[model samples]
Target: MKPNLSLRVSQHLALTPQLQQSIRLLQLSTLELAQEVEQMLDENPFLELSSDDGAPEPDPQAPADATYSEATNADQISAGDENDVETPAVDTPDDWEGDGSMDAAVEDGEWGGDGTVRSGSGADEDEADAADLARSHESLTDYLHRQALSLRLSELDRAALRFLIESLNDDGYLEDTLESLAVGLAGADDAEQLDELVHRFTVALGLLQSLEPTGVGARDLAECLTLQLHAMNLHEEGDPAVVEAALRICRQPLDLLAKRDLRRLSQLCATGEEDTRQAMALIARLEPRPGRRFADVERNAIVPDVIVRKTGRGAQQSFSVQLNPDVMPRLRVHDIYASALRGGRGGEGHQALQARLQEARWFIKNIQQRFDTILRVSRAIVERQKNFFVHGELAMRPMVLREIADELGLHESTISRVTTAKYMATPQGTFELKYFFGSGLGTETGGNASSTAVRALIKQFVAAEDARKPLSDNQIAEMLKEQGIECARRTVAKYREALKIAPANLRKAL
Candidate 1:
């Protein structure tokens, strides 16, 4: 064996901590960025919000102009070779602690490397105050526990019921059966105890089924439906004959009900089609996932990063894309703290303070960069999608991330980060940044059409369709073909489903 040595030259990129943070900030939605701003303010003492209470009240337009400049600067900085594979700056720490990536974010800004940030002035006008919707919701588990508190039972019975309550899934279906639960409890206690636990669970099962949801702790879909029916039996809407008919229909195959096979259902229930139809209507009103409504679902606000408003009238009309002031945090280094940090103080504490000061400056700069990238991308998108703004979605052309990346001299991934979670408000209303990018379909004129445009066409056709004789997917495809779209029936069906339109039979009036 022999070993040979040779000198080789190659280039690769390493993402700095600050660059990574900038990328993350770029992708975060408006609400998330605000939360990040609040967190940084709390964690970094050097960082403080810019305001006009004690400070001198400046011109309202000052922050807007300042924001423009900051965004421009960031765009200028990152408008480099975006395709550099080794551009490892996209991998920075999420927070400003430890290595402090914020330092790496803004190289030449107001901070000027010495890390002294001049406090900013007033807020931007476009930064509308976000509508706060905070409500304390009672979770499914908590709701069950509260009801359990009112029940009178022995300790063992309550324990077993509580265990069963805990075992129920989010949809209020019991994932584990009493037999299985008893088998698992067998190892924990003697046979007599196991028998007692089984008996208590059996009794608890009936009581749990009687919860307000009417289907809280059932074993399967059939059981869940049966529990609801049982509850409805005691209600004012309850019809004894209807309940009897429904019970007979439910006891048969589930597949029959799903298909809505009216004649077959009537035959199976030994009733007329009219009776079967009424019984099925009762089932339709039943809540399948009773606990779903109580889930603590966090509803996010859609605050647009860019606002595109039309300027000029008639032939001179054009859209102007600018940053939304509400989302851009009016931030700077605390003037008092920055002045103190600038004074030549020497100590271990002094170095730590200096680091914190730098972090604050970096945080401000990175946030600026994030908005800058967003603005640049949005401007480009507006430029490409002007037809869409003027003529509706049918005028949209095929676009990909790479096209914007090439035009802006940014990496494809950087473009993706800018588009994700970001939104634009325009004359046609607000839409996601990624919504404009769609695959091309060949046109009869040797041009390409946006899949988005095709979807829009499908939506229009369905909206105008006659309910008495709804257009099937095949008919829709034919209509598209007449317009030189060359659409297949399957494609029309897919677009129809994506738009949440039902099938022809489903759309037909009964």
Candidate 2:
């Protein structure tokens, strides 16, 4: 067989560096972006804070020029206008003025008296940045060691305490018993020493319980609440009656307290309804998680991708398709250093420096392109899912990457990258970009409903069910069928699980 060469024209998708960078930047959470920016700033000397670009100055001499300057920005300058063309100016306030020269204006402000250096002065105070709560809390072991320092315990005892602290879970509860702890510590120098260590640990246990969250370091709920009551008991030293009342409440069965049975609790405490109520109220106030108070709270600051506000026009809306600002690196190429390298004034490393300079520019450019791509994709999403904005998930039409890609005149994979990990803020709530896409479930009529809407409907049915006889998955499926949903019982169960809900048996009332 002869191998024949033929020319064919076809369409294909490619993953360019710019496209890859765009995808990476699009999905990054707010905190992730800040970290990325910091990394870029360190690697690329070219980048600087947007605020460091320069501060606004009052210039009476160029009032008209100031107005023009105000209008000029990164976005405006980048977009060309054929009819209204602009040339690089000789004298300007910027570090790299419009002049063709690569050399930056000196510290003398030869360009203008308003030469604001893009360094330390008035940088953008990383506003609307992701919450960095993870950094705030001290580790359990570190806290235990610090507490141990105040106690008059032996070195072996301190070590035992450290081990116990290490054994404590994230909720700050010690998981092992004294015997188990002793067994664990037996690997040390002496067995007798381990016994002594256990004794010291008992004292440390009290200290841990007393630390915070009132009830933390407790092995169980009963112990946890009891520990908190004990703390409150200690604070009521002057009032003997109050102290006695607290002790009685602690000694009683915890099931009564958990159920919030006030009348029975008053009788059990052997106090008046008011004092018992106060004690019950006090018990309620004590935190179950002593360590959780100190534990780092993972803060997920939701930034809405779309901002819809009511306007004078008939339901006017605007979508601010912003990249998580934190992720975009604040960069500006070092003109002075770059020029020196280009001019061959620098040594062998000049080549490397030039490469770094180019990389920095490329990164920034890619980032800008990523934001633009996200904006375009998000706008397309809003356009297609406009009904969702007016109504809600119930109104959300079935969408897929192909649909969006076709609309945007881009490849399906490009649409995928835009949607993946990216989120958009809507009037309903902030949702991942992918939330808009779902397979269509046909109704009895020609119309279709999203899987998300069906799940929501199922949730509503379950919420309104009789608690004594909770609606089973099969029952829910039947109900959906009645409503013309045509869903299977297993599908109902799957959606229930996805919603993090248990089966009807588990959800049943006592």
Q: What does the lDDT read for residue 466 in candidate 1? A: 87
TM-score of each: 0.71, 0.64
Error of 2 at 367 (Å): 0.9
Model 1 earns a TM-score of: 0.71
Q: What are the per-residue Cα lDDT tens digits for candidate 2 across 437-506?
A: 9887778886777898898888889889998899998999889888887888888998999998878866
How big is the positional error of residue 81 in model 2, measured in Å on the Cα after superposition? Answer: 20
Clashes of each: 11, 10
Candidate 1 Cα outliers beyond 4 Å, as residue runs: 1-9, 29-131, 134-170, 176-187, 236-243, 262-267, 295-297, 300-304, 307-331, 334-359, 386-395, 406-409, 425-430, 445-447, 463-470, 500-510
Q: What C-alpha lDDT values do all the predictions have?
A: 0.72, 0.61
For candidate 1, the lDDT comes to 0.72
Q: Write the per-residue lDDT of candidate 1 for residues 346-444, one digit (tens) a residue.
A: 899999887787677667777766765676788889889999999989999999999998887677887888888889888898899999999987777
- What count of clashes does model 2 give? 10
